[model samples]
Target: MSSIRLFILSSFDLLGPMHGHRLRIEAENRHVSLWTEISVGAVYGAMARLAEEGYLRQIGEEKDGKRPVKQIFEITEEGRRLLAELRRSGLTEIWYKHDPFDLALVRLDPASAAELPALLQARLKALEERLAEADRINAWAAPYIGVTKRAALKHGQHRLRGEIAYLREVLDDIDAIVAEVAAGKV
Candidate 1:
């Protein structure tokens, strides 16, 4: 599913009529980038495309002081239908994206095996940093956000923790892994 499309349609459905600029601001304010694949810069383009596709319709235009006229838009019945479909698919789908690290692990040569520990250590460090940041964001947003958003934040944290634990286990067995790789048994 297109996250941008879902976000745009849902925002319109929930917030009434809004211009592209307002949508972009709302996306940023909601920290969509942190939780979803939506890019803040893509909001305007997506809005334009949604209008072209008849999912959205321009209702009016507003001018703020010297700024150019902004075209306000609202979701159509088609958009609402699309939004419902996206929500259903998104909630029901079990998406497990493949990580390149798994490929690298299976394809590791004896020489690369020796270097795996350092590389894994670096990745672990980065994941730790990300977890710390997630914690801070959760603490800051907990009072303002609903349970669903808090659950999303916790989901991200849990994934990071899982990876961190896996890395530590691998690191603990690095010597054995290197031996296996050297023996061409891995």
Candidate 2:
């Protein structure tokens, strides 16, 4: 199963029966987008797909005055079993052999070398911005989350800092390469 499905199932397990809207709100309240690729807009579609798959079923409908009726969904026995299996086995698995930057770097040519510094600088800027956001998340989440969770956030920030440092070194190397090419020495 995809991580998104697993996350949605886990959400139902944590929050109990909820409509799509409530699930989206819960995801936002938990700041899921800060850590995962899942978006708030994807929740409703995932709910529909899971419902169609029999993993989730409509328990009832809720109407909030002027708003349209909302379908309440709950996890089924199959879903519970799958969730347990995923938790037991999936939690131990790690996959990290994917990075767009790796591909770009591999394909870079001397003719296009001038663009590398700018691209790397842009990525450095973005990573720095993400580090700032992580700080904001840490400040707010520290009071509400446990020590282990706070550590996980710090871990991400630490990893970003390391990447930023490495990228700076690479930019320095690129500067040397640019100068050498300009002087026809490379």
Stretches of candidate 1 exceeding 4 Å from the true structure: none
- Identify the runs in model 2 with alpha carbons over 4 angstroms from their true place: 175-186
| Residue range with the least summed lDDT across 10 consecutive positions in model 1 | 106-115
Q: What is the number of backbone collisions in each predicted candidate, taken in the order shown?
A: 0, 0
For candidate 2, write residues 66-161 as lDDT tens digits: 999999999998888878877776557774657787676656656777777888889999999999999998998899998877876887888889
Q: For candidate 1, write residues 4-69 as lDDT tens digits.
A: 998999999999999999999999999998788788999999999999999999999999999999
Candidate 1 deviates by what RMSD? 1.6
TM-score of decoy 1:
0.92
| Model 1 C-alpha lDDT versus the unseen true structure | 0.91
Worst 10 residues of 2 by lDDT: 177-186
lDDT leader: 1
Give the alpha-carbon lDDT of every model.
0.91, 0.82
Model 2 error, position 2 (Å):
3.1
Report the CA-based lDDT of candidate 2 relative to the real structure. 0.82
TM-score of each: 0.92, 0.84
